[model samples]
Target: EDLWVEIQANTFKNWVNEHLRESGMQVTDFHDDFCDGTYLCALVEGLQKRPLKPSWNKRPANQHHYLENATTALNAIEADGVKLVNIGNVDIVNGNVKLIL
Candidate 1:
């Protein structure tokens, strides 16, 4: 179970990196304050369940809006025939990571 969690986390990290690259965004440390494994996992899971469709015409200006835009953009690319492995629940209990893939 422990090993599986690590594998899933790494896979999620790689997925994020790939999307960031495709979107022409700089790759940042996943452990950085801006984002982390748990957050990425959650975001990807949300995306898988219901992909975001952002209005490109009404460009967002704030940080919160920017994040939403980014998510939408990534989802758009994925919608272009890129099949991403579905990621489900990502929970941390008693300092142990639990992942559903």
Candidate 2:
């Protein structure tokens, strides 16, 4: 199961990097790369091809700021007609690998 999860996570990372190439952003590790929510926001923006409402903080300083950024990303994602069940900003900010993938 661990190996399968790793492979799935790597696939997602590759997919994110592909979409974010134009933006010059990359997802190195699904678990650690999204801890601050910067890359996650970028990925969502790339996917939506639009800016997020209530813009996210480019440079998050604390946990609260990270959560805010994640919230913006998740909300924008949902706004784009993608339903995320049982996942929230806290999960992203906390770097929950399972939920993130």
Which one wins on TM-score?
2
Could you tell me which residue pairs clash in candidate 1? none
Across residues 9-89, which tens digit of lDDT does each residue of candidate 2 receive?
989888889998988888888777798888988888887888788888888899998989998998888877889999998
* Every candidate's lDDT: 0.42, 0.87
Runs with alpha carbons beyond 4 Å of true place in candidate 2: none
Write candidate 1's Cα lDDT for 9-90 as tens digits.
6786677666545334433333341222334433543445543454432334454543554445445547767654542112
Question: RMSD (Cα, Å) of candidate 2?
Answer: 1.0
Query: Global CA lDDT of candidate 2, please?
Result: 0.87
